[model samples]
Target: MIEKTISGQDALPNISDAERIFAELLTGLAAAQPGFPLAQLKTFVDQEFAQIKHVLHGISLLGQCPDSINAALICRGEKMSIAIMAGVLEARGHNVTVIDPVEKLLAVGHYLESTVDIAESTRRIAASRIPADHMVLMAGFTAGNEKGELVVLGRNGSDYSAAVLAACLRADCCEIWTDVDGVYTCDPRQVPDARLLKSMSYQEAMELSYFGAKVLHPRTITPIAQFQIPCLIKNTGNPQAPGTLIGASRDEDELPVKGISNLNNMAMFSVSGPGMKGMVGMAARVFAAMSRARISVVLITQSSSEYSISFCVPQSDCVRAERAMQEEFYLELKKAYWSRWR
Candidate 1:
């Protein structure tokens, strides 16, 4: 082992000649700054210069690729972002294709020697900027169209876009990397004891989406759900950590309901009627009336062949829906009864 002198503590174990070199890098960095944030300092080390088991490991850690990868990342127009993204994936030895502005689809297609697929981006870009295995989709942006910039999928579009691209590629599963480990009964940032769900069905994710789960977009599941593509939500922050899987994995001894996702602005409606028993199309009529008024329903539950039924809707539309329901389904309303609005 090479000899090295240090002024501070020997915190790192299994010191090696190469490791000592890396260790000296830290000292050199420290010599430049006596007071540096632990987090930021560590980030510089882990990000810029860390010992690698393999060259590929170094590439993966750098988030770059040697040739190319099968996956594609859609993001809004930002040359710096693209450059940085390319750098990271390139380090990981992945060939990343950056597609921007919806307009680039055709060009990317023509150049790649492939045809554009609308339902999903499944074109072979043999001559394109990206590789043949790469895909197409909108980039992640809040909302709106940017000129010359690739389409922003909007809100949770990246997640949806990745799923769709994965579908086009027919990948076994799509793993979403985020800051948190996985889905919990409540936001882990909020509830410390928020239980993590091992697995969740599409319906459950849908319910959560309706209740404003930031993890997924509502439109995402329907397409993939058509093909039943399972998604794993993993924490980009902690790679080795176990994340939650969203699929049809039902645990026999698990909670009948894995998690409870609640929408904040909700209005409850209670519709009751003895005459409504075995109601022919009363349920349908209630919804139809609300539809006419453009009122949205959130949750609903009814008794079996009974006179009473209850549902929830947007709090803002409660009065309008209630009035509509009361006016249309009045006869059934009198015998049984209806109350509770918002």
Candidate 2:
């Protein structure tokens, strides 16, 4: 029997839902068969335990900031999810300060009780007084928009939060740790031969992510690129491996196309009529209708003759877009001024 050593970090309340589901699965298997591949199950559980330990160890190492650099950390999710990260940093003899970004900036005012004054959160992070050697961990969520309303950055808002923090603080670099080593030329799950990119330009990364690469959020690049900060994507389980780096520029590589990505469930629409030829407001009316319908146009093209316009949007929005156009051009449709292409 192998003896295992455990610490408080080992019991962190992260991924509890996952643990519950796993437990239920094992329970069901055990109930069905008294001896149902217990060895395989045990091996899987052990691997999970080891992965957790590795994560905690890697986080602790991050606390050892180099003399030349000052570090700030941003974490997403509830406080319980981040406790282990904070606890481990403090255990390593580093002063750890936990802050809520909403408290610092008026743009993202307090949600329930308190009020946030008119202050920019990015400015606050840049001007923080915490010692260079100390560490600050921010629990991040949605931020405020220009209207002072809470705006969630979507499911991957955490990545946006980290980039904002790094850009504000002018950190040397920003790193994101995930399950995979780095960004691949294509999704490895679909293309087993997909190659990992050691480094890529910000433009390439942005296009890939926007087109459908899931490694990074589309918004994650905005702040980092605005400040020209290099961002790295690394594996939490295998910290030793060099992951992908995204920067303003990289050495020219032989590959002209970085990777292939795509989006599904999309539809194209074409609006055409002789009345649209040389008409200035025709395109505007069409787009206005789409805007009013809250349908996002993905791609757009117009014929050189100005007699027709074509655009692509999410397939789910096809009906909405069509309805909006019909209402906006009811008179034109009734008079045969224009017709919608199927």
Best by lDDT: 2
Clashes of each: 31, 0
- RMSD in order of candidates: 16.4, 14.3
TM-score for all models, in order of appearance:
0.51, 0.68
Please give the CA lDDT of all the candidate structures: 0.56, 0.67
Per-residue lDDT for 1-342 in model 2, tens only?
A: 001112224334444555566556655655655445445554565456455545545555564422111111112223333444564455456687766564454433223212222226656755667687778786554454445444444447677777877876778999988899999999999999999899998999999998879899767887788889999999999999899999998648638888998877888888788988787777677778888786767778899988888888899998988888779988878988775556
| Stretches of candidate 1 exceeding 4 Å from the true structure | 1-130, 133-137, 141-155, 185-191, 198-214, 248-257, 273-279, 292-295, 303-306, 316-342
lDDT by residue for model 1 (29-111), tens: 45554442334434543443233223334344455533211011122123223444444454455656665424333212111
lDDT of 2 at 123: 66
Location of the lowest summed lDDT over 10 successive residues in candidate 1: 67-76
Which pairs of residues clash in candidate 2, taking residues 3 or more apart in a chain or in different chains?
none
User: Which TM-score value belongs to model 1?
Assistant: 0.51
